[model samples]
Target: MPDVAEVRRRTWVPGRPVDVLATLGPLRRGAHDPTWRVDPDGTLWRGVRTPEGPATLRLSSRPALGEVAASAWGPGATWLLDSLPALLGAGDDVSGFVPRHPRVVAAGRMFSGWRVPRTGLVVEALVPTVLEQKVTGQEAYSAWRRLVRRHGEPAPGAEGRLWVAPAAVTWGRIPSWAWLQAGVDGARSATVVRSVRAAGRLEECVDLDRVSARRRLRAVPGVGVWT
Candidate 1:
């Protein structure tokens, strides 16, 4: 088995101390499993469950690396931290959103990892949306895994196939036969193909506020309120 330290080196950060050692706790859930788990302490930990055991990539260490991960994941997390004190400070009651989503609200005991990615949002979120135009989620996720494993890059940390979702350019170039191998049909494939051509346009949604982002996302060729 490889050293956990070696695996740790590949935590996928951009090399900035502030990002690596965030002021608050890790908010990225499932960072330690196939799903990234964000700890209450704000430690964004990503783990690769090896045959030997679990190899963890913790963010609270090595300030420089953490900073990079922070930025690469999108530097908006810093902004979230700044507003957190005001939102949860003295006399600030947040029960409205808490009771609605008890699990998330209660578990969210920190002020980091809230900012969603901009480009990857378009890339990763679009995976299911593109493949699910007229099919089931199982079919879409399955297709995502198949195609990513085939055409996507290797995940920074993991034993099995953790996909680095193909970029827009790559998506635009994927052949139709590849889609079939992943169980995706022509109609859905066409939508993904068309959208990939306008990757920049989809990424533009990231800068907009949540409401506007969703609004513009819906305008994308294959994306919709239901999709």
Candidate 2:
């Protein structure tokens, strides 16, 4: 694995490599090595080894101003570390945190170092969230991998992660036929299209309290609890 400290030491533009980690957390979720890579332009990368075979990560951080927010989720401590900053309010007190589940707590301690991590926030989450509504995890993720791998740019560093997601302006330009090919039905496609227009405002939710942030996100025409 590459050196994590070395990657973190580089300077970055507002919207690329630095922010991808800021928003997505570790791309491998709860792997032992737990590494992420960033292309100079901000596209993110990671590697995984499942029982079936090895895998790699590549995606555009697609960050917007104020979009560097992340959320706690999944079955392990990893997400908590990455998303806690947003759930409890950025830079919150972890002293009172006590997990009800023993394993999750143990996992939390294991990954505690990233409590304030950056998960590319903004359009990164926004794009996926828009695709997830009223659909199974399978559907949304399938669409994301397809569209991004096809239309998104390539990663830009020594590492080989996928490129970042398209810009809002670029998202809007994705033709309808492209979404169909990616297996996104019309409704989910529409949400993504509209979200591209409101990318900036949507990311601002990261700055608000979790309740307020989620509520505000729901205010978007197509955004709801499912998103």
Candidate 3:
């Protein structure tokens, strides 16, 4: 609805084998996540709220051609397309990783194409992760699905009922009743609200060292070792 136009497209040929799904799979909150979908034809669809705006991104791997074709729609289409390589793990460095155990070696070989994706959206990653604290996967995922579906906007060009997660300000403004209705407890909801309120500082963690990032994250109330 935000002045969406004809789809913007890009083709990326990574120097290493990129397992798009495996790299991005960890981002999916659950099977019923409103922000993620996989089509029958093996296309991966994601609804994201980038710094520019909301966008719908589609990715399909062309094994024969050794390329991945990506397309996007909405105000943030260009931004999403521009970040595709990093989002698909182009920045991941595994040159020093050495698998010592037999199982580790086997898994490395099995998932050689898999790389850790760097989304660089700290608030987006943190909110749901906070919800998952001390709860079963089912409960956390259910609450996440409910909250996103209720507060999020429809993705511009998603084929089905996909949505982009609410912006940080919106997350902070979510009502207590609304959070309760979504099965999120007061403590968890409070953490989410607090995290979003300090989103600027949290986003800075992307540029900080590992120790500093962890220390900063621990400063937030209700966030701990497990979180």
TM-score per model over all chains: 0.52, 0.57, 0.95
lDDT of 2 by residue, 1-227 (tens): 33221222212233222234543452322222223455587665443221112233344423344233321111222323333334223443567888989998997766553444444356665776677667776776677777766665443332434334555777888999999998888887887888778877876876787898878777767777766
lDDT of 1 by residue, 60-135 (tens): 4444335322211112233322222321222233345444476666655453333222222454456556676677
Q: Rank the candidates by TM-score, best first.
A: 3, 2, 1
Q: How accurate is candidate 2 locally (lDDT)?
A: 0.53
Give each model's whole-structure lDDT: 0.48, 0.53, 0.91
Evaluated at residue 43, the lDDT of candidate 2 is 61
Ranking by lDDT: 3, 2, 1
lDDT of 3: 0.91
Off by over 4 Å in 3: none
Which of candidates 2 and 3 reaches a greater lDDT? 3
Candidate 2 ranges beyond 4 A from true positions: 1-92, 99-116, 158-161
Clashing pairs in 3: none
Worst 10 residues of 1 by lDDT: 68-77
RMSD of each: 10.4, 12.4, 1.6
lDDT of 3 at 10: 98
